[model samples]
Target: MTEVTVLGAGIAGLAAALALRDRGVSVEIVEQAERLTEVGAGLQIAPNGTRVLRALGIDPPGPESRAVHLIDGPTGRSLIRMPLGPGFHLVHRADLIEALAARLGDIPLHLGRPVAGVSDGGRRLDFSNGQTRAVRRLIGADGARGASRHFVAPDHAARWTGQVAWRALVPVAGWPAEAQVHVGPGRHLVLYPLRDGRLLNVVAVEERAEWVAEGWSQEDDPQALRDAFANYAGPVREVLSRVERVHLWGLMDHGAVPAWRRGACTLIGDAAHPTLPFLAQGANLALEDAWTLAAAGDPAAWEAARRGRVTRALATAQANARNYHLTGMRRALGHGALRAVGAVAPRAMLRRYDWLYGHDVTV
Candidate 1:
């Protein structure tokens, strides 16, 4: 029997274990955290990402957004409304995490076991408890800054995207059954209902001269979030006013690393490709990487199969950061063009994204 060890029990790690298990490989997942819980507010599992989940028999039971609205901050005028198909599903982070955790039945999970190092081309790993394990194969689904990543690629260059993001979930009785994005000169606010329309998910972002901290656990005052978007429309104001808590994190642009494989070990998800969250594809890309790594059967083949798709996804996300934060004439023109597209032909505009949402990496 082939025994594989996966570092980190995140969405990526859990997906990798399940995929490998389905292929008749024994998988053991080691997570540093004491409990299997998720942070953050809401995440989108685009049709592309959901394909892998469905294949793994894990269907995220969150509401799907019918359309995505990009609007002006003050007027709330719909600049563009991208009509969505069945692929654009909105989910609370915890809900999706729960769904994935449930599907990972019987796979060995070692909690509070942080990895110390990997050696002998990743066939061996030392844990914090001073124990070492030798495995037939290792998958580094640990994340961008996990112990497994350093073993494969010791040095990586990262740059600040000059932006910060804040997330919070507000209570809502009734709101539009769509994803809404309000854009301003240097900031944007996105809100959508989640969990059967009982709670409202909110995320606000702004360009900063300097980078904030790297992690997402840092909390920001709700007043600061409100003050940042003070002049926005009532809908945004109401959401912020209802926010009792907020989590903030810096935006970073980490390009594709050339090497993510060594002998019997390989990387997946953020451990493989880390990018800005502008595209909301962090989890989606991770899910794809997990399925590809397990199904491809070899590190080289996995890299070859996933490289182009991930490269393009990263570029698209970088482009969105600039597009959403446009100012002056460019902002006006961009909004005007989107408004025109919404009024004249909405579905045509959505077709531009068909390549992304239509992708199926489950196989």
Candidate 2:
């Protein structure tokens, strides 16, 4: 039987485990945190992402819990409105974590056992708990700052993208049913209903000169976030004012590593390609990575099959980040063009994203 050791139990990590497990591979997850926790606000599982979930046979929560709607971010106008399809859904990070964690029932998940270091040549892992283990395959899903990147690409450092994002969860009753994106000069705000409309997820991004602390729990002034989007019309101000707790972090971008794998070890998710949230494909891409990695039977063949897809996804993500941070004349020109085209033919503007949202990962 093939045995795999998955590091980090985030979306990518757990998804990898589930994928391998379905193939009758013995999989164990080692997580640094004491408990499986999700701190980020909310995530949208697009059709491409949802396809991966369905392949894992992990049925997500009921439709009532994950209401889906589409709203214009800048003007708060209703662009597209509809329920989440079976192929795409909205979910809280914690809920998805819990669901994925549950699916790996009886699978050994060693929590609080941080990976201190990995021996690439020896295929050995030194854990913070003073234990060592050797495995046939090592998965580096430990996240952006985790030990995996250091082991795989120590020379490459993550670059700050001159932007900070603040996320919060407020009562859903106060928010619109549709996912709202408020675009403005040098700033953007995204909001969606989560947890059966009981909680509303808010993500606000703005260009900044300095990098703030990384991670989802870092505190920033809610008022500051509000001020950033104050000029944006619609429900943004209302949502910002209602945020009781806000977690802010600098959105960092790293150059895509040429190779995501080294010898018997490979990288997944943020560990390999940390992306800005502009495209909202971070978690979705991670899920796709997990599926692709698991589907490959041979290590060598698996790496080759996945390398291109991973690279393209990462590159596209980087491109989207640049497009999202438009400033000055460029910003004005781009927005004017979008608005002009949108007014002329709204469906044409939406069709531009069809290549992205219409992707069928199952193919």
Candidate 3:
């Protein structure tokens, strides 16, 4: 009998399994996908997330990110370059997934088991193959659209954010090991290197009235992406011109779920709270959740302790979305203020996020 059954084999589920198993809890994983695919773009692992990986005895998966360079997208003018401390990494999503999955030794992983529905107050799982299993406890890491999330917050809904993001990879050699954010009016482009600086990851966002489908699998014409940021000059334009393929997804604001637990079941990661990409805390918070849940003696207490931090992080990300797309006078004022801050005390800019990157859950 499994003491805990984690849904989804993505970062959250796999990390939860490893954390629980390390604590001597009997754990198993259920994933709908037949096999883990290499279909993903790059992701940033902040120091907070990196601390968790190190606690789990896993090494950092990618090249250490040295800095974040903010730029003006239209003219390609550098606004500021904030240096990052130790433990920040720019990793491919597949590489991080593989890293977590590799440490899950001998843990029972059930793939190709799409959940049909969850019943019996979250203790019973019904799979699409007409199989039913009663679990002692359920950890819902199956993501926003998965059945585990539905079981925890049945009435929870997400609204489209009037924005869509395009993600792609372009081949580049000897790119700098830093993240660059090209901020424009109502749009922004983020670029960073991955896999020893051989591939440049691009995530371009634009405010749009039309709603495209959500999820990362939706493919759009590379020309559409190019057209969206046609005004961007310099290296930004040059990078977009080389894009051969891209994936597009509509950004949605699900906020935080009303409840993360119901009886023997609880939620983690995207199932509990879906965060915007602006803050890059989705995976980091998931890692924190996995470790905290395994270490907590009481689920309700854990939620209470975790809620305030998650709420703050979500709000920060939302603010960044607005700040990145500032227009007209606001853009001028914001950029000017940033430039002033960057000039006088550039290290102060990075120090502002000490509350975020400095946190250590394992300690």
Q: Best candidate, lDDT-wise?
A: 3
Candidate 1 lDDT score relative to the true structure:
0.85
Positional deviation of residue 247's Cα in model 3 after best superposition, in angstroms: 0.5
Q: For model 2, where is the 10-residue window of minimal lDDT?
A: 62-71
| Clash pairs (backbone) in predicted model 2 | 69-179, 73-181, 73-182, 73-183, 74-182, 74-183
Cα misplacement distance, residue 311 of candidate 1 (Å): 0.4
lDDT (0-100) at residue 101 of candidate 3? 90
Score each candidate by Cα lDDT: 0.85, 0.74, 0.92
Could you tell me every candidate's TM-score relative to the true structure?
0.96, 0.88, 0.99
Ranking by lDDT: 3, 1, 2
- The 10 consecutive residues of candidate 1 with the worst lDDT sum are 36-45
Model 1: lDDT of residue 74: 77
- Candidate 1 is scored at a TM of 0.96
Checking candidate 1 for backbone clashes, the offending pairs are none
Q: Model 1 over residues 1-363: C-alpha lDDT tens digits?
A: 348899888889998999999999888898988887767678888899989999999776687789988889977777888888886788888777778888888998889888888888798888878998887888998888888788888887678888899988888886766888898988998888888888888888898897798776899999989999999888788778889989898877768777888777798888888867778899999998888888988879789877998999899988887888888899888888888888999888778777788988764
In model 3, the Cα lDDT at residue 199 comes to 99
Q: Candidate 1 at residue 37, lDDT?
A: 72
